[model samples]
Target: VCVPPESVQPPPGSHLPHLSSRVMANLDDGTQIGLAMSRSIGDPEADRLGVIPDPTVEVMDVGALVQEAAEALKVESEDEVELLAVSASDGLFDHVTPETVALEMARSLYEKEGAPRPLLAAERLIMLSSRFWIEPQQVAYRDDISLAVTKVNKGGKVKA
Candidate 1:
């Protein structure tokens, strides 16, 4: 359901397209649901030419993702896993290490958003990094991680 800016334009001489209303509603909803990636071109020439940047929206079923991850990791319950989503800004490169960036993000979430910090301290941490741009646009990468905690039983044994 990717509604590019170019695709949402009204026909020449018309007030609005028939599908514009529905598309706008979907895009707005996607943005609120964290399924949309909005990026603007930083090139001055492109901006002067009236280039409108469109957002890329992807809808994901989180339940299905958790189930798949649990199976892949051979975990008994999905409740043992936590998902962390973080976006890297232009200043991210100033950090010394990826771990530092991750820790800062986690701390911010805990302090600002009141997110539980213990979830971030899970035993297994899977980091995924994605680069969106090559240059000027900051060459930013969005990092997402799945953290899972394996429960331990009495007598110092790990429970499956």
Candidate 2:
């Protein structure tokens, strides 16, 4: 999500030096998601004003991508993989950026095909990353489920 400079405002009572800091975070599987802090969803105000979807194709399965790359590259560990988000603008932040975490793995796969759809890569990464947000039972079963969020969270304890 990208926020315009004009719309960005600090919380009700806080004094920050400037606007627009880049925050990048890496997930357990090594996918990087980068967020333009000033414009990121962290701040509801900024997010509501303006936000943009990533242009690159997202790769959801970061770990799977790494494994695939490792196998393709003949590398032993996920650490051996390196990725760069071509669309990520440069900046700094106190915490990891979601875009940085998300795009890293996407870039790796995109690069294999000579820089294809960056947004598409991002989407793919997101889909794969859903593996971690899944229910423990689903993970164990390795089966598709359409359980409602309420039921899933309560482990079927909630009464209808």
Candidate 3:
């Protein structure tokens, strides 16, 4: 819910929206907003500028995923995961690639013992983002690390 589309691709020959980078949307007044995403839950100012509260949803068969990972990893032990779901704000997404997040989650879940540690996976992803992306900056800034990792089983049980 935090990353904007990065850049808006206006249709064929149309003009782009009048906005700045990152935040994307600009106000009618001489105001530069720091709002992150193009979609938000509740922000009247950003809403006026075309940010909607709509969300994108996807459904998939985690059984197939489980089998696929079992085959790929070649170890169908108890640590074999059913599903790994990562939800984060722009802080993580901007700093790290999806693959990096996936690897971190996979390692946290598979390499660790006992029940899937989605919380640890989430923490690792956040730390990874801050450590690699923000810590090396000349002027370090704090972005809200709103993230969660969820493990969903075949029986629709969720653990976080």
Candidate 4:
């Protein structure tokens, strides 16, 4: 998780430049990079700000979460909706939450035009999230978005 640059509990004994939150770190190459991520790789300046590449393992039941959110979408049977996992870059998460994506997928399943599928749901999610990242009214940025969605049958086979 990325904490505020100005937050208390800064890296132990690492004195950052003044106005720490605005500018993350200054590299030896005369380039300054601003970032708040707590864990990363290939960033020497970030190391000064206490960022580490060490990964934290968090185990969660994403399938249960999606199933709960898509409770309204179970038209045929209880097992009709079996979402196994979700992966996305910060670009997608900066604008939308997992709950929003799950709810949107559930909503997409109800469309009247054609067959409801997770692939279509994934496309809708990218399009919706892009509005927040690229619009001038919103927080505009050049960061790209990436994510995945798929269904899993009882036999553990994946369906796109």
lDDT of the candidates, in the order given:
0.43, 0.45, 0.64, 0.61
Worst 10 residues of 4 by lDDT: 16-25
* TM-scores for the candidates: 0.30, 0.22, 0.58, 0.49
Residue 114 lDDT (model 3)? 54
Worst 10 residues of 1 by lDDT: 123-132
**lDDT tens digits by residue: candidate 1, 107-157:** 544454664454443311222222322232464444333332232222333
RMSD in Å for all candidates: 15.9, 20.0, 7.0, 7.5
Residue 53 in model 4: shift from native, Å? 2.6
What's model 1's TM-score? Answer: 0.30
lDDT of 3 by residue, 57-103 (tens): 68777777777778887885635545668777777887888888877
Q: List the residue pairs that clash in candidate 4.
A: none
Best TM-score among the predictions, by candidate number? 3
The true-versus-predicted C-alpha distance at residue 17 of model 1, in Å, is: 42
lDDT of 4 at 54: 58
| Each prediction's number of clashing residue pairs | 0, 45, 0, 0
- Between the candidate structures 2 and 4, which one is better when assessed by lDDT? 4
Worst 10 residues of 2 by lDDT: 145-154
Which residue pairs clash in candidate 3? none
